[model samples]
Target: MSDRIVESCRMCESSDLESVLDLGSTPPSDNFLTLEQLNKSETYYPLRLVCCKSCGLSQLSYVVDRETLFNPDYPYESGTSKFFRDHFEEMAASVTGKLNLAADDLAIDVGSNVGILTAAFQRNGVRSLGVEPVGRLAEKANMAGAETVHAFFDPDIGQKVRDSHGAASVITATNVFAHIDDLNAFVETIKILLKPTGVFVSESPYLLDLVQNLEYDTIYHEHLSYYSVAPMRSFFDRHGMEIIDVHPVDMHGGSLRTYVAFKGAHEVSESVGRYLANEKEQRLQDPEALKKFGAKAAAHKAELFEFLYELKREGKRIVGIGAPAKGNTFLNYCNIGPEILECLTEKAEAKVGLFAPGTHIPVLGDDFLENEQPDFGLLLSWNLKNEIMNNLSAFSAAGGKFIIPIPNIEII
Candidate 1:
C-alpha cells in the first residue's frame, strides 16, 4: 500500500484513538523535486495527528510507505550543519564516559545518516558501525572512514551485525526512533544487537515542547510519533527495558535524550520521575489539552499567514532562509508558494537546485541572499535561528530583515 490510515496505537495496539490536529493533506515533506520531476504528479497523504487514550502516545493517523518516504534520493545529511556535528561529538563523548565504554567496545548507530555520530564514536575511542538504509549515504559514510551497513535495520541485520562485530556496548538512534513504524520490532532488534548490560539511547523532539511551543510544523509523514515520557516509559517496560535517565536538550526546538537499558541493569535517575511528574501536571496525555493546543495552532497559522500577506502587499520582497523538511510542512500548511516566497536559499548542495516538495518554490544557494538582497527572509529553520542569522550577518548588514515564524511571528 502507498499509504493507509492507522487503526490502532503504534505502541500499545489500542483502538481508543482521538483526532487532535488535522493539517489536511500534504506531499511528503522531504521529497525535494528535481527540475525534470516537477512536471510529474505528486502524491499527497493525510496529515493528521491523533492521541492514543490507552497509552497516551501521539502519532500520525496515516502511514506513508517507507520505500517512498526514504527514497534513494533522500537529501538530508547530518554533517552539513556544524551544530549537529558538535552535538553528535558531544553525544559520543557523554555516552562513552557515562557507560565507561573502552576501545574494545562496539557502538552502533541506527539510521546513521552519513555516519556523523558513528565517526564521533570512533573519535571517542570506541569501535563504531552505522546502519543506514540509503545506499548513497552508506557509501558516503564508508568513504569517509566510517563503516556502514546499507539496509533497513531489522532482527536479521541486527544478528548479522552482532555476528560480525560482536554485541554493541551502546546503541544510539538520534532523531530516528520516531520514524519507525514498528516499535516492537525495532526494540527486538535492539535486544538482539545490545549486550546484556548495554544501553539504548534515543533522542527526539519532545511532544510537550511541540504542544507548548505550537510547533505544528514538525508534524509530518516521516515522524510517525510525537513522543512523551509516560508512553515511552510504558512502551519500554513492555519490552523488558527501562528508562534510566532523561535529559532535555536545546535542539530541534526542544528534544529529550533518553537512555534505556535492560530492567535492573542500571540505576534509574531522578530525572525520569521528574519528567513523568511534569507530564502528569501539564495534562500532556489528556485529549482536552491536546485539543486546546490544536485550537491555538490554528489561530497562530492564521495570524502568521496574514502577517506575510500584508508584507507582500506592501511591496516587500521575501524569500525563505532555509528549506528544511519541517519548513515544507509550514509552507504547505500556510499555502505560501512562490507567489509569497520568490525562492528559498539553502546551504546544502543537495537541495540548493531542487524545489520545495509541495510549494514548488525554487531553492537557490546561500549566496542568493547577498546577490539578490530580498527585502525580508522567512526563517524556515527557526529552531536554528541564531546559527543561521549569525552566518548571514552580511544580509542583515545590508538592511535585510528576517521573519521568525514559530513560537510567535516576529520580524527582526
Candidate 2:
C-alpha cells in the first residue's frame, strides 16, 4: 500500500466520504507467486472502501502503486476464452456499425490486453491502436494485428498518439476505466485523443450489481472505484463530456456498457434516464444502502466459510476452479488456503505453475482435474460461471459438485 490514502472521491472530489466495506489487508490479486518467488516475502495492502456522499462513487480508500500492479508479468489475456473472443468480435462489429466507421476512421482501446478488441477492429478493416501498460503483453500484441503503445494512458501518452497516429474516431475502454485512480486525467486524455465527433465508450462493473449481489470479492487493490450512472453523470458532465446512453450487460456478473461523447456530439437517450430512475429506486447513493450492503457481504462470507469448513471436517476434498485475480481476494479475505483448498486450476499457461498470493494455494493446469479430482470445486472465477459450468460437465456428471459462492452460495 502507498503511504497515502484518498481523502476525497475519485470522481467528484467529495470530502464527505463514508466507510462502506473493509475486506482487510490483502495481497495484490494478480500477484500469483512462482515456485521461486514463493520462498520470498509477499506484499499486502489494506483493502477498504468508502462511498463519496457528494458524487455517490464507491472507491478504494488506499491507492496501490500502478507500476507494481501492472508489471511486465501481468498474466491476463483477453483471448483466454472463446466466449470472450466471440464477444469481442461481436462488440467490434456492433460498435463500428453503430458509429458508421470507415476504413480511415481510427479506433483506440485503452488497457488493451493482447490487443484483442483492437484486433477485432482491424479484422473489420477499421484502423486500430492499443495503449497497454504491460510491455511484455504489448510486444505480444503486435502479432495480433493492432499496433500497441506500451505506456500508461494519460494526457502525455494521449498527445503522443494524436501526434503520431492522429485523433481517434472511437475511443473504447473495457473494464479498465474503474482501475484508474486519477480519473480526471483519464477523462482529459479521452478528450485529447478523440475527434470532435468521436465516441468514448467505457464498460465497467456496475456498483449496483456489486452491492446487490454481495460481490465483495471484486473489491480488490486494482479496482479503485465502483461507479453508477448518478456519479458517472456528474463526473462526466464536469469534464465536459456527457453520458449519452447506458446499457446493462451480463458480463462481469453485471456491467454498464456506457456511451459518452463531447457534450453535444450525440443525443441523450431515454436509456440514461431509465437507469438513473432505477438507481434511485435501489437507493444506490444512500449511505444506508451501503451499510446494508456491508451487512449482506458479511453474511455471505460467513455462509461460505461455514460450508467449506463443514466439508473439510468431513474429509471431503476441495479445490478451486480458476486462479483469477478475484479468486485471490476471495481466498485472502476468507483466509482459505492449502489446508482447505488443495489447489487452484487455470486454463492460462501463464498461471499454471504459479501460486495464489497471500493464501499460497498452488495453481495447476485445468487438465490436472483428471489426475486428481477433488470432491468439490469452489469456483473462484464465478463471474464466468456459465463458461466454467459448461466446460466441467463431466465433473458434474461424476458427482463432483461445484460451489458458487457469490450472489448467494449454492452447491450443485
Listed per candidate, the RMSD to the true structure in angstroms reads: 0.8, 1.3
**Tens digit of per-residue lDDT, candidate 2, span 212-252:** 88888889888898989999999889988899989987767
Scanning candidate 1 in windows of ten residues, the lowest lDDT window is 1-10
State TM-scores per candidate.
0.99, 0.98
* Residue 131, candidate 1: C-alpha displacement in angstroms: 0.3
Candidate 2: residue 7 lDDT (0-100): 91
Model 1 misplaced regions, further than 4 Å: none
True-vs-predicted CA distance for residue 186, candidate 2, Å: 1.0
- Candidate 2: deviation at residue 410, Å? 1.1
